[model samples]
Target: MVPPTTGPTHHLGKSEIEYYAMLAKTEVQHYSGTNIELGTACGKYFRVCTLSITDPGDSDIIRSLESA
Candidate 1:
């Protein structure tokens, strides 16, 4: 989860730590949008530096992203 401006290092240190931890556990997908954009997509009101898609449910997001 690399932001556009800050690259992999966002201002919030916890985000970076979570990113590494998530990376070690599973496949991490790179979001091309900024943190703000990601937050909007997730229906949040703030920046989201990292998002964990634990269960995609019925969505085709996993397949689409993997194909891309």
Candidate 2:
């Protein structure tokens, strides 16, 4: 996978690195919706204080939140 490029501000940047790292190291079960406290869970990624996708479609939204 390509390394993530740095963003303009330090706090807000591409999640490619984090996502891929989670993809590689975090177990699928850790992502279950029941585990809201898990950092890798879908809920954490969608938390309003965090981030949002641009122009995401229905399937994209599902793919982002519905996956474990």
lDDT of 2 by residue, 1-68 (tens): 22223223134343544665577763221122222233243345532222334354564543544552
**Model 2 misplaced stretches (Cα beyond 4 Å):** 1-13, 26-68
Q: Which ten residues in a row are the worst by lDDT in model 2? A: 27-36
Winning candidate number (lDDT): 1
Give all TM-scores, in the order shown: 0.59, 0.19
Q: What is the lDDT of candidate 1?
A: 0.64
Compose the digit string of candidate 1's lDDT tens values, residues 1-68.
22223244455765665567677765656677777887887789988777667677997777777687
Sliding window of 10 residues with minimal summed lDDT for model 1 = 1-10
Best by TM-score: 1
